[model samples]
Target: MRTTGGQLFMLVVINAALLAVGAMISGGTYLSPFNLQSMAGQLPEIGFLAIGVMLAMCAGNGGIDLSGIALANLSGVASAIIVGSFLSSTDNETAFSIAFIAVALLTGLIGGTFNGLLISRLNITPILCTLGTQMLFTGIAVVLSDGRAVAVGSPELLSQIGNGLFLGVPISFLIFVSAAGLIAALLKFTPFGLWLMLMGTNPKAATFAGFPKARVLIATYATSGLLAGLAGVIIAARNVNVKWDYGTSYLLIAILIAVMAGVRPEGGYGRVICVVMATIALQLMSSLLNFGGLSNFVRDFAWGALLLTFLAVGRYNLVGLLTPNKSRKLV
Candidate 1:
């Protein structure tokens, strides 16, 4: 498990290819400050979901997060409805904001919790369990909205937080950094992180080693759900209205980011930094494409291509990524 620059180089190549194609589709320009800023704003929610999914994707554990999009849409709609119904424009803003955060966080937590329970206790396949939840969340959202979008008030406040800049940095970017830092500390410094990954890589051995497999699996799913909820809230905050399919578009990209972020679908291998960098690269690539006037769909295809390529690399061990390295990657 040695990490090497060559392995990292593969990631770079993937990124460069994505950037080049995105630019081509976008019609030329591939770099822009505004686009970077926009990507910064967009990444947090996507990053959150991607990271959430990554935690549970432990290899040999046969787990994956296919329901994040559905969970996000459901949790977001739930947040808006709960907050909007309870607090009017006339109510105290302080209480309203607190309530908003709580409701949103709780909705996501519950979705995640349910996912964990089903996978751990019921012994359902992660894919099947999450698929069920995904359907449940999406269906609930549609039913709640009656196929209509519910508009929220005081978008200015939400915008201020969602679209805010602090010390010339996007608040959302700062949040992603902070979140990654916290998780990195846990993963690199704490035993729990190691154990959780251990569960993913070799569940039979993990059980032999006395790890609580079910709890670990459940917790990972729960954490993923929580992050998805956070992303849901952020996206909902950005939109003036909450719709049933709010996160439908992000589902595929989230999976792409999770894979590119270095989460081995086999379960036990991946990095948050992988998620962050891959996501950033995509963000940058898409921006470059837009600036160049490339068709959005074409830029999207670039991403699809990137996913296909890396997946091949992963499966075939074609690149040096699967090899041991001289220098170890930082935790």
Candidate 2:
């Protein structure tokens, strides 16, 4: 088994423990089919953002995408204005749906391209670039909507995508799973993935070996932007409106999920499977807390505490300390 498998196992154990305790406290309401399905429906939005965070972390260099939720909001706002102008959701459902999705994705791609150009070509630091872009995206969104939420009206097809189920699984969750699978394959089987990992692991070695750093960075960030766009679509689908300030806490939560998945901050190594498990683990924990009648503020505090604990463990190599290597031959 790979290192990811061990990490995944730990996450699974955490998830199970949370579920068991939740069930005990909630008198099995937590384990009911309805609650499980609700959890599945809730997973995709954050999962998509977390994947984008994972990609940036995998690229190293203090890499992170603070702009993901901002860009996602921008994408949704732009889509609503553009799609709503030409087509009525009630009278031209098909055309409106097609145009809505296209505009959302295109907006996301363009925003992502902007980030890639600044970071890859201009040599801006990833964190700084994304932070600036996050504000820029939010500004654009606020100006476009005049700081108010733009309502999408929950069109039939959009609602189905957001809340519908097929074969006893939420469609949004399936979409999340599909996206995760594609990313896993991209990282495992493709030359770009190899170059990316190598670049993150040892930038000097990759540069010396003639790797195309610009192309890799551009593609990686663009892909991250695409994911953000998809997340925007889902967010709009689930909610009746899109606003600049919506999901204000999402950026931090996404980063938390990536870190919990053990994505290295200095770059080089991350696993999509581990990220998937980490996401599920988090959702379970959040649900468990909710079942326990905890307020959202408490939940946020708990998430922050957990994030700090994990970061400290990683920083101090606590796993190494707890499970000393027996292969040292007594030093």
Q: Per-residue CA lDDT of candidate 1, range 3-99, in tens?
A: 4344566667767787677656656544355555677887788888888777878534678887887777777677777887868634566566567
Give the number of the best model, judged by TM-score: 2
Task: Give the clash count for model 1.
Answer: 14
Give the per-residue lDDT of model 2 (tens digit) for 1-331: 1244445556777888988898899999998989999999998989999999889888877777889999999999999988998788888777777788889989988888888889989999999999999999999999999999898887778888889999989999999999999999999999999988888888889889999998998888898999999999999988988888888889888989998887887788888988888899999998888777889999889989999998986666554454454212111
Candidate 1's error at 287, in angstroms? 1.7
Lowest summed lDDT across 10 adjacent residues in model 1 is found at 322-331
**Would you list the clashing residue pairs of candidate 2?**
60-267
As a whole number from 0 to 100, the lDDT of residue 163 in candidate 2 is 90
The whole-model lDDT of each prediction reads 0.74, 0.86
Listed in order, each prediction's TM-score against the native is 0.88, 0.95
